[model samples]
Target: MPKAKKSQAKPKTKKAPQKLRQQVAALPVRLSEGGQIEVLLVTSRDSRRWIIPKGWPMKGKKRHEAAAIEAEEEAGVLGTIQDKALGHYRYSKQQADGREIGCRVAVYALNVTEELADWAEKGQRQMQWVRSEIAADLVQEPELSLLLRKIGPP
Candidate 1:
């Protein structure tokens, strides 16, 4: 009888680039007054969910600068850095053509100083200031939720 032939193993293939790996900046603004803390929340344009202001980094702006810019554009609010950083979170955003993109967002704590009546990029589904604990619960992303808990009530 002929000897059995040895089997050969195939090499692993490289993964394709995921659609969602874009760099973005986000600010978590918590407003405090008279011992009460509130968080700013913005409803996304698609009206599918609520989230904080965030966007892609601009040509020359640093991440924090981009975060401030996004806040102004999305929520009509001007803010200053309050603490080092709340933390980071990852989520998926859907594109126009229905493609799901993975996103990693770095979040910083900001103290809001002003709220402009007009926004550069209008059409946010909604905007509101909710209590910190409620705001944390309202957000759907797990990582963001965890960050909020870590920051704790302000």
Candidate 2:
């Protein structure tokens, strides 16, 4: 019998790129008695690191509006959100299912009108009002630190 010929296999195909996603964040701010600017920060549910209130975009609401809502829910703040975004930062979000997905966050300034005594997630998170320089030192993300350092009028 003749020797059998070998068959060649096709190479594996490349994977498609992961879909990009975005979220809205609120940087709550207020003027102190000494006429200094202050930025509000909240702790993350998992790591307890200082961060702004942020969450997934809401349907039918403007990005700024959604950011304001996140501020209220996560940090017990009510404020006027700037119509435009202050800036943006990117990070990998860790989902409950253990998936770390890349995400870009649009940050809006929320001129704090009031601070509620109680709000959603109040017990689960800690909130603080701090100076911009101190806030810059506390946040983990460099881009976010830059944003915090620059937190001022416009």
On residues 22-61, what C-alpha lDDT tens digit does candidate 1 reach at each position? 4554554564666667778888888547788888878997
lDDT of 2 by residue, 1-154 (tens): 9989888789889888677699999999998888888899899999898899999999999999999999999989997899899999988888899999988999999999899999988899988888888989999988999988877752
Model 2: pairs clashing at backbone N, Cα or C within 3 Å: none
Candidate 1, which segments miss by more than 4 Å at Cα? 1-3, 9-22, 28-32, 82-84, 152-154
Best by the lDDT measure: 2
Q: Which stretches of candidate 2 lie over 4 Å from their true place?
A: 1-17
Instruction: Report how far off residue 129 is in candidate 1 (Å).
Output: 0.2
* lDDT (0 to 1) per candidate: 0.74, 0.90
Clashing pairs in 1: 20-101, 20-102
**Residue 68's C-alpha lDDT in candidate 2?**
95
RMSD of each: 2.8, 2.8
RMSD of 2: 2.8
